[model samples]
Target: MSDAQNTESPASENPLSAWSGRTDGDAPEHLRWHQVVRVAEDAAHNDADRAGTALIGFASDEGVRRNHGRVGASAGPAALRGALSSLALLEGTGALVDAGDVAVRLGDDETPGDLEDGQAELGRHISGLLDEHRLVVVLGGGHETAYASYLGLAGSGRVGPNTRVGILNLDAHFDLREAPLPSSGTPFLQIARDEAAAGRTFSYAVVGVSEANNTRVLFDTARELGVRWMTDETCQTADVTNVRRFVRDFVQDVDVLYLTIDLDVLPASVAPGVSAPAGFGVPYEVIHACVSEATESGKLALADAVELNPGLDVDGRTAKAAARLIHTIVSRHRAG
Candidate 1:
């Protein structure tokens, strides 16, 4: 089915809102976290607060449908907002803002399906936020969000022919598909091509690749492109020292870092809501450590948690896991 067939409403309608949630507490005098947090227009970024974090949601799964995966990742943004609502504002949480979502535009016969267009819109917003000097934490519609996030990074005017931008992806698959159309599995390759065209180097590395999930061609693609990766077999608690070493080296090399986490990289026990759940995914604790180490490096320019399909979620574990990771990266970014 086409992407236009998946949604019940038109794409341009704003699917975001001023975030409101539970506020039950023992004493009114006690400090409550949400009071300080900003939402919708109030959360809109400005130069006055360079140390704040802004939230943007890419609420489209058209790429996933084109990739032939399960649907419903478009619901992820709302799920993330709900999951993060009641959490405490930890030290280094930073000033927060919600910029709402960039959703899919259901196409008619007169208009062609354009998921790329939505991605471009997201890129513009991401660029605007970065221009304002706010750290961006994007909520995803699918792993496809990576391409748009990449655009946002490039949009910042930070990249040039002699310069390089580092991309650190945590995923079970390389997502370097050579497809005629852009899909969730094709963002990285698209980024590579775009960088090459712009006379820039695409410095990419993946953590948590599953041999069972990726074909031999994908492996060759990774090798052919000189992409560095640590397999799922090596991303264990026992191997964390090496994992940290790999991440630290990657973090130190980039002028600006784009961190993308495809949630399917986590063990299925911890995240079963994704379109492609991993049978033997990397452990969450290990992923957390890698993310924490990277964020703490202070070079992480932007980050996103992708592929939480709430339609298949069991007990909300997957959304919770994604939210925890988001919290960790954003909090740590603030602390740094």
Candidate 2:
């Protein structure tokens, strides 16, 4: 299906149409009709107190495949917004803003500067949103923004030993491969490699890997970096708390953490709508459990839910699951 077909239908002619009313019931106003921002102005202005959390959604065409299949992942940001609207506001104490997608350049023979420029844009916007000390949740144009988020947050002089922020990732592929420069799939690797080069090493604990399917090179890289991992074998029988504890101890030096969730970690049975669905994966509860614990730990600076291409979803199952995960994340923060 086309990206347009996947997006939620426009507001209907119901009474709530004119105003941001709840025609669909009790869903929040911000979640409905959140326009896709192609520029920075729309993402820059926001009242810190009024906005509980700021999550800017956007995508990059790099690593995007044509077949018209997962390449439609560019539609992920919009698809997720449709699912997040009207969600149970959990504790009813927070606000989320859809700061539109970060404008990016796409196509073959794309210049490396394009990726750098996109990261620069993301860094500027994320820094602007962090002005309030509010947790910045970037909903992702792609996983590459993790580098920009770290660079911008670190550059602002806010990232330090107290935050004890570490990275918690759930992905099928380790994405540990690096290029002479960075690209969409190489963000985390660049983040760690670059930071360590700057004498600021980052600790990342990952879960839900598929050793059977991953390349030997990826495994070697993770091992070399001392990254703690919980592959498919472990995810099959481990409790969510186990993974959370790994994060709690690994990230003792920073004050806030950065969590990146790549939907490929889920088994095809659960997260079927992603760009790369694997066979055996963690249950959805694991995601919520991890989110709850991390937020309760008081060091979650930013959390990202990536790779949800609802255009390929069946019955909105995966989309709803992602929305619920974000809800619990917000709820946990409110509880603290």
Candidate 3:
């Protein structure tokens, strides 16, 4: 195993620090996320059948560097954890476990580790966690988190060639760049290729696409790959009935779902800390409604919130928005 696969202990260099929040009485009704959170290492001896949400961090933005975007998204996971720490834990959310992180190690020369290797390590860890938790939510480094999330679900043995796996990406870009190497812009393309190679059906849909941001060729590529998408303008102006129909149709077509949220999909005013902020993006209520639709379908197996660049955030707006979406996901999810 590579050094990245060696999960760090909270006592050591684990980024999951003391999750401090408001003090409520010892009763479960007053609990918040920080209060109920347990370290994966500490719970290693616990029952495997215990139902809970497993949170893993992918602390590498090498893909963003390769794609020539902002570089600070590597800190996304920690920022997300900090944002989630104080949130109220609703009843039925069940147990929440901190599974440390799958981080890109720095070499002696200070260069970042290989992105592909780190993704593989993340996949292995996520696959193992699936057996223990009902939901596995990966806090990400970039949109590259989607490919690694796919890897985990593919390796988990819960889905096979015959299973229809749906991928719902909420982002400003289609992320289908044909790059020689894997980058944040190339994860979905890589996933399509992998599905083709393995003879598995690829069911992918993207909401909140920006026509001004993506090239014509990218649209052509998405069309050629049979991708389903709705433009940002459509999402922004469409009525709730139309949006719900779109999401519900996609959710009904697949047996399992992997939902990925790229923070750039939201308006810049709401989420300015992403590598690419949206000038005209989907409204927060629209995004939240979509997330609720997916989770309530009982098909959501894995999910992630990516591209939260704390370095660019203004008063933690991006993290807070992402955390709210995550809160909605966890609260509504019906784990299978």
Best candidate according to TM-score: 3
Q: Global lDDT of each model?
A: 0.81, 0.62, 0.84
lDDT, candidate 3, at 65:
81
> Which regions in candidate 1 have their CA more than 4 angstroms from the true location?
1-18, 24-33, 43-48, 106-112, 334-336
- Specify the highest-lDDT model's number: 3
lDDT of each residue in 1-336, candidate 1, tens digit only: 113333332222332343456666635343234545565355444544557787888877788888889988989988987787766666656677666777865333355357887888788778877765558888998998999999998978555567668999999999999997888999999999998888887799999999988999999998888899999999988998899999999877887788999999999999999999999989999999989987888778799999999999999999999988988887778423
**What shift in Å separates residue 194 of candidate 3 from its native position after superposition?**
0.6
Which residue pairs in candidate 1 collide?
A: none
Q: Report the candidate with higher TM-score, 1 versus 3.
A: 3
TM-score of each: 0.89, 0.80, 0.93
Model 3 lDDT tens row, 1-336: 124645332212444474677868679888889888887656545554247788888887788887889878878988998999989999889778877777765322245457787888888778877767778899988888888899999988667878898999999999999987788999999999999988987799998999999999999999999999988888864565677779999999998899999999999999999998899999998898888988999989899999999999999999999999998888777765
The segments of candidate 3 whose C-alpha lies over 4 angstroms from its true place after superposition are 1-18, 44-49, 105-112
The C-alpha RMSD of each candidate to the native structure, in angstroms, is: 4.1, 6.4, 2.7
What does candidate 2's lDDT look like per residue over 214-325, in tens digits?
6898888888887788876666535666766755665555556777787778778887887767777877777666667677776676777877777677888777778777
